[model samples]
Target: MNWDDLRVFLAVARAEGLSGAAKTLRLDPATAGRRIARLERSLGAVLFAKSPQGYALTEAGQRLLPRAEAAEAALAEGRAETAGAGGERLSGTLRIGAPDGCANYLLPQVCAQIGAAHPDLDIQILALPRVVNLSRREADLAITVSPPATQRLRAEKLSDYHLSLAASRDWLAAHGAPDGPEALKGARMIGYIPDMIFDAELDYLAGFGVTRVPLASNAVSVQLNLARAGAGLAIVHDFALPAAPDLVRVLPDRVRLTRAFWLVSHAGPRDARLDRFATLLRDGMRAEIARLEASVA
Candidate 1:
């Protein structure tokens, strides 16, 4: 039950092998093996079963893994808290995972300002089409269209943006805009590919009583671009349309929908770097949310 031995055990559990764990811990393979053995002996359990494939965790290891990882995170949190007490420049990578539309349209300005403020810190934005797994430490922070329902995670409304059905003026002139909600069923609709709809919120058309989308894509940008190209009518965020003068909202009053972006983080110990960045992000978003809502209004 030595803390050092537990650290070695945790590393091996993650790396799944002695050599990889040794590489990670910067310990010789022999020493790493000895640490694991010591931990196993102290705990009186066969923690891992070695095989040709790798070291697979036994029941004891499986049970201890989460506790050990939690301990590691707690230790890191202590270090981050200590560092936060001093007024030193933060120098580490902060990874943020966000959906495509928000990542593309909202993040550039926010990230630019953040970069200017924290030149020593590297910000990595992973613009993904799907939700990131915060439980597995996939990202330091995530902006999700839907609030996370998972335990040990904190989620707050980042901003509420307006969505509406839109099409290029050229397309509207060519095919004609739908006169009513009933007519929209036959309109040439561009939307997310049915199976690729990661979040239920992205299923904008279904609520409008439209079942068929003739042209579709997994990416929001592609759908927006397709609408801009006069291919079809699309459900798009109002904030993304301001620059594209050709696209016009089809049903200004009737078809409007509002969705909020939720900022989510693991409910682990707080870090000054994360706290500062979150505050910056939150404040910037508060200033922009009104403009975004007004654009549609």
Candidate 2:
């Protein structure tokens, strides 16, 4: 089988649609579709079952997946072995998926500094409100609030960060600060939508007796904006506090919570370029979180 055709097949399988696979491979949608058709003809077997929802792999495709992945890994290993043969800087795209809060507040500076040092490297950050699917190739790397439970992926703890109840100075002036959790009664709370909380780690208000959140958003940035606009008190990441200078922590001692960030990626052969980049990213996150939190403190 043509390796290029297999590569296209792998991309389609991961993306689950021609358009998405085309985007990832930098090919036109028509071209991607034609390639898949050609591959099926050559193999004399159907690879995918098409539906309005998306492409679903056929039994043939399922059987072919492992062999294709092995070939892909071998090619990746070869590339890694020859990477930077002449002291060349890291080039090509590195896409990271992260929760919107971390994506909005943490990654820009860290990625900017990395891009500055390696001018050829292109970085893409997907500020998704849900868990990034590594199996779907949604991102080359993902920064998650909790470690993935799947054994197919590898995860490393980056840093532990804090969150505290905060409200706009204007809101506090009007409503008065809550002395404790019990004092939160009758307060207009801002937080994630109850049923839309995707991860257990994101259910920040669970133990605080906050049964209702009148102002809610799945995206942390939006919640922060609501708090900044004096809508109500919300739990804000300590590293994100500097972005809203008008906001002040309420019940800091009693209502504070701690969480850690995990760097997650597909388990595979080590690539020197990715290793170096991961190191820089990990250290940058530690420093940035410390700096931002200290400024708020």
Candidate 3:
């Protein structure tokens, strides 16, 4: 019946492991386990079934999930209301999940500015190569290359960014620039591993008839580094070009592609502070992309 116990239960359910839940809550694993045991004793029902894989919720645990989530949301709403009433700066944690490319190139500056304004805000950027799982509460918000297909999440287009074939100046100078996309067949290519691409938007080389990549990685930052090292031609984001001055577009006119970033979050009532933060994030990303792209142009 204790709200704190319910909070611990929700964390364990989402993380699917006591250690992970304990890490999130900043508690010792033994302490978290004891809390769960206490909660089960109070409810007179076993909540989790432990296994080698992890914790699996029991029927009783499943039943309590939604109600626990509602209580958590209500607590968040109350905090937001109190903060607004007092005109206090944004506090507590905000975790954002994003592909490594965006996380590395875009978010640091944007988040730094937000953090500067609200010194109390604790922002964590999870630069994961795969799509962030909002359903499991991996992150409070996510920036994705494509809009999520699920109805449980809401998506908003933040910006359209360009990408094109690029290679280091030295590489082009040594091997000669490709006359067009067709000439790329002879060049060493760097791109995402064919089977490892997590999203359709990340399959940047497929449309160009590129079925082979001699050098490949799932992470964009790694591909960029390969291109920068003069390993091969790779499709590079225009906004990211500023970071690698040695690299230049190879076939800008004939090989240009456009993609967008979507701000994705769980669909439901949210804290007003989150709403304001989202606005700042959206506007900041748009401006940063434009400014970076223009600099390279």
Clashes of each: 0, 0, 0
Q: Total clashes, candidate 1? A: 0
Candidate 1 at residue 256, lDDT?
84
TM-score of 2: 0.70
Q: In model 1, what is the error at residue 245, expressed in angstroms? A: 1.9
Query: What is the full ranking by lDDT, best candidate first?
Result: 2, 3, 1
lDDT of 1 by residue, 102-181 (tens): 88877776676556656788989899999988888899999998878876997765655788889999998888888877
Q: Top model by lDDT, which number?
A: 2
Scored against the true structure, residue 115 in model 1 reaches a CA lDDT of 65
Query: Residue by residue across 61-164, what tens digits does model 3's lDDT show?
Result: 98987577556545543443344355668889999999999999999988887676677999999999999999999999999998888989977666667897
Off by over 4 Å in 2: 1-88
What TM value does model 1 have? 0.68
Clashing pairs in 2: none
lDDT of 1: 0.79
Error of 1 at 100 (Å): 0.2
lDDT score of residue 240 within candidate 1: 82
**lDDT agreement with native, every candidate:** 0.79, 0.84, 0.84
Please give the lDDT score for candidate 3.
0.84
lDDT accuracy of residue 276 in candidate 3: 75
lDDT, model 2, position 97: 95
